[model samples]
Target: MAKVGRGLPAPKSKRRVKYGPNVVRLVCEDLASGMTYNEVTQGRGRPSHSSLYEWRRRYPEFAEATDAARAFGAEVCGDRALEVAEQATEETVRKAKLEVDTLVHRAAVLAPERWGGRGAGLRRAEPIEVVFSVRRFEKVVGPDGRVCVREIKPEGEV
Candidate 1:
């Protein structure tokens, strides 16, 4: 009988991403069209976000194009969020609102200057309902290395 040997994992193979002309165009367009790095990677057969960043670092043109696209993408996300908020129906209100919030956050992250920064939240073309929640908590981390949680008192006391 052959005995198997316990050994370290094999070295990772070098994955060569094909940065063809279309690759550059598509990546640039995705960014320019308001798609985040995560979104770009979500597409079928797309490269990882890290790879996209690495490519940008290696290629000056890619970096320039991506930088230009960031603001455009932020604006697009902001616009789409507003549209979703407006078109949301009673049945899909919760889902649509969540989507709006996500887009707003992404837009803000992409271009805080244009979106009025973190504290300002998102810009809306028209008045739309926004829902937010607040919670209070008390952190109790003992020597046991486990977190002990307690409800925070209303009077600013834990």
Candidate 2:
């Protein structure tokens, strides 16, 4: 029988240890510093890429940080979109108001008794219907105390 000598009673099986914040921070910093996943794993010696990926997935702090960064990016994009929308709305409202004012002024000048003089009750003009195929007009109150569009019927047309 061949004599098989046990080598130093075989080293005790080490318990699997969860890495602490410091280790995770070090790995994250290394990654941020342009170290690849393979390089980080090789340098840390304690964790493999798969294990590190799992830890990052399981860790709440890491997940929260990632989510926060993503939210910030989204917020920036949303703010830009909001700014553009606000500007366009302002311009549209300004243009609409100007058009309404010009039309009112012309009506007042042409038919002072119908539109400008005292006791000049509500008078309907020709029903001017504008069709917008691409854009729809949103009914909005203007600074002037009147509706933007007042439907007017043609003279003597019931």
Candidate 3:
């Protein structure tokens, strides 16, 4: 029989991100052009998403710049949505509306202060619907002889 070693595997070294002015500039440009954080972090030679977040944590200026760039990206997405709406025709109306809706949703999430929750731009197609339910509780004895409160289903419910 061959002898097998029982030692732990070697630890992999972490990728070191090179911080530079151009790195920040390029990241900001992509963000300002409406690219998401995951999108920006993709591809070879780019820093991982966590590294970008770490940089933001390490440098307050980078955080602020990224925040501003994200807001600009939201605005850019909003503009693109508007353009899509403007160019929609009878045949393309459904697809155009879907694209515009997606872009507007992204914009609203990215920059809530600008276009979220009844703001001046691009309100949702339908008003939000809220439902309320009253749950009934009943005391039940468990197999362990412990009493616990359980939810009681309403009548005619399966």
- Provide the overall lDDT of each model, using Cα atoms, as 2-decimal numbers: 0.80, 0.54, 0.88
TM-score of 3: 0.63
Give the per-residue lDDT of model 1 (tens digit) for 1-158. 65465476764454555776787888778887987687777645567777887888998988888877887899899889999999999999999989998998888788777774635555456977999968677989979889899777678554
Please give the lDDT score for candidate 1: 0.80
Q: Over the stretch 1-158, how does candidate 3's per-residue lDDT look in tens digits?
A: 65565476764455666978888999999999999998898776677888899999999999999999999999999999999999999999999999999999999888887878675666558988999989889999999999999988888885
Taking all chains together, the TM-score of candidate 1 against the true structure is 0.54
What are the TM-scores, per candidate, against the unseen true structure?
0.54, 0.30, 0.63
Q: Candidate 3: misplaced stretches above 4 Å?
A: 1-15, 120-158
Residue 23, model 2: Cα distance from true site in angstroms: 0.6
Clashing residue pairs in candidate 2 (N, C-alpha, C atoms within 3 angstroms): 125-152
Candidate 2 differs from the real structure by a C-alpha RMSD in angstroms, to one decimal, of 28.6
Q: Please give the clash total of every predicted structure, in order.
A: 1, 1, 0
Poorest 10 consecutive residues of model 1 by lDDT?
A: 116-125
Query: What is the C-alpha lDDT profile of model 2 across 1-158, one tens digit per residue?
Result: 75576455863343443778766666666544434456666632456766767876888786564344333333343344445445556548766555555544444443355435455475657788998744234455678866675345456755
At residue 39, candidate 3 shows an lDDT of 88
